[model samples]
Target chain A: MNGVHDLGGMHGMGPIDPEANEPVFHNEWERRVFAVTIATFGGGNYHVDQFRHAIERMGAANYLSTSYYEHWLHMVETLMIETGAISRDELNAEQTKLAKEAS
Target chain B: MAVLTADMVAGLASTGASCRLDETVAPKFSVGDHVVVRNINPTGHTRLPRYVRGKRGIVDRDHGVFIFPDTNAHSEGEKPQHVYSVRFTPRELWGGDASERDSVYIDMWDDYIDPAS
Candidate 1:
C-alpha cells in the first residue's frame, strides 16, 4: 500500500510552469461563488464556462495539493467573511471551539 | 458574530445539504479500469488530494457514488463523487527503484482515472 507522502513525485513531477499555474480566484468569493453556482445551478458535474477556464488555468500542483473539501472551505470561508455570512471573529471562535472539542 | 451560534450553523447545514443523489440509479464503471480524475479546483471545497494527481491506478472495487464531502466543509452542502478503490504500483508513483513487493491503494473517483496501456 502507498502512503500519502508516496505521491510526492507521481503525476506532478515535471518542471513547474508559471503560465499554467494561476490562482483560480481574483478573490475568495469568486471561488465560492463559482463552487456554489456549480453545485446549486450546474449539472451533477460543475461546468461553468468561465469558472472552468479559471480552474484549468490554475496548474495541477496547487489544485491537487488542496483537499476536495478544502477548496470549497477556502471559498466559503472567504465568502462568509466578505458577504457577512460569518464574521472573522466569529469564525475564529468557532474554529477554536471545534479545536478544543477535538482535543 | 455572537448572534450566530452552533445551532444556527447546524440549521444552515441541513438547509444547504446537496449531495443530490439518485440512489435508485446505478453507477457507470467498476474497479481496475485506468481512468483520469478530472482536474478541478473550485473556490469552496474539494476532497481529491493533491498527491495523486495525473497518476494512474487500477480499480480495486466498486465504491458507490455519494454526495461529495468537500461541499460540507465549505458549508455549500454535499454532492456525489463516485468513490472507488484504486491500486497504484509503488514504482508507477515513486520510481522504478521502489520496492517490487510494494504497491499503493487509493480511494479515488471515476474522474481520476484514464486508460493505462
Candidate 2:
C-alpha cells in the first residue's frame, strides 16, 4: 500500500531534530498502549504484518499527526474490532466511562 | 486465544518474535547478480517500499528464508522465500544528481525482484 507511512524519499518534511535524552514514553497512556499491544500480539489474534497494515490504513492526515505509540494504539483498536475480539460500541462505551471517571 | 501472563512479559520483551524461518529455501539470485525490482502495487500489505519498485540493483547478500509479509498479513500463508540484501546505487534510485559514493542496501524478498535482462 502506498501510504503516508512510506516517507523514505519524499522531501519537505524538515530535518529531524534529535531530542535531548528522550524518554521511553511521553505519557502514562503510552506505556499501557505498548503493553496492551504486545499482550494482544502475543495472543496471536493477528500477525505483525497485519498490525503494520492497520497503521498504514490510517488516513494520511491522521497518520502524519499522530505519535508513534498512538499508531500502535490505532492498530490495536482496529484489529481488535475487525477480528470480532471487541466491538466499536464496547470501545466507545469504555471510552465514555473512562471520560466520566476522569472528570 | 492464549493469554499473556506477567511471567511471560520479560522473556517476550527481551527476545522479540522473528519472522525468519528455519527452512532451507533456494534463492533465485546469488551475490553480485544484477536484478530488477518488480513493479508491483498491491492494495494489501507489502514490505516492498514504493521507491524501490522497477529499480535495478545487485544482490549483496542472502539473508536466508523468511516469512513473506505480503501474503502473511492477509491470512494468505507464510509463503516463505529467500530474502536478500540488494544494493542499489544512489544514481539508480535517486538519479544522476545523487552521490555516487553512497549505496542503499534494502532487504528484498524473491517475489519482489526478478532477473535483470
Candidate 3:
C-alpha cells in the first residue's frame, strides 16, 4: 500500500537528525507498549509483515504525528481486534475504566 | 494456541525470529545481470519501495531464499524465493541531478523484479 510511511526521495520533510544519547524508549507508556506488542506477537496473532501493514494502515495525519512505539501500539490494537482476541467494545470499556481510575 | 510463558520471554527477546528459509531455490537473475523493478501497486502489503518501481538496476548479490512478505502478510503462503541486492545508480532512480558516484542497494524478492528488456 502506498502510504506516508513509504517516504523515500520526497523532499522538504527536513534533514534526518539523530537524537543525542537516544534512549531505547522515551516514555514509560512506550516501554509497556513495546512489551505488550512483543508478547502479543509471540501469540502468533500476526507476522512481522502484517504487523507492519497495520502500522502503514494508520491515517496519514496520525502516522506522521505519532511516535515510533505509538505505531507499535496501533498495530497491536488493530491486530488484536482483527484476530478476535479482543473487541472494540471491550477495548473501549477498558480505556474508559482506566480513564475513570486515573481521574 | 501457543501461550507465551514467563520463562520463554528472555529467550524469545534475545533471539528474534528470522524469515530466512533453508529451502534451496533457483535464482532468476545472476550477479551482474540487469533487471527492472516491477511496477506493482497492490493494495495489500508489499516490501517493494515506490522509488525503485520500474527502475533499472543490476543484481549485485543473491541473499538466498527467504519468505516473500507480499504473500506472507496476507496468510497467502510463504512463497520462499531468492532475494537479490540490486544496485541502482542514483541517476537511474532520482534523475540526472543525482550524484553518479552514489548508488542505492535495495533487497528485492523474485516477484518484485524481472529481466531487463
- Best candidate, TM-score: 2
The C-alpha stretches of model 1 lying farther than 4 A from their native spots are A1-103, B1-22, B37-44, B69-81
Rank ordering of all candidates by lDDT, starting from the highest:
2, 3, 1
**For candidate 1, the TM-score of chain A alone relative to the native chain A:** 0.41
Interface RMSD (Å), every candidate: 13.7, 0.9, 1.1
TM-score of 2: 0.97
Model 1 chain B weakest 10-residue run by lDDT: B1-10
lDDT of 3 at A90: 100
lDDT, candidate 3, A5-64, per-residue tens: 888888878878999999998889999998898888886777899999999999889999
Tell me candidate 3's TM-score on chain B.
0.95
Which tens-of-lDDT digit does each residue in A30-76 have in candidate 2?
99999999899987888789999999999899999999998999999
Ten-residue region with minimum lDDT total, candidate 1 chain A: A41-50
Q: Locate the minimum summed-lDDT window of 10 residues in model 2 chain B.
A: B92-101
Model 3 lDDT, residue B43, Cα: 88
Candidate 1 yields a Cα-based lDDT of: 0.55
Chain B alone, TM-score of each model? 0.62, 0.96, 0.95
Ranking by TM-score: 2, 3, 1
Ranking by DockQ: 2, 3, 1
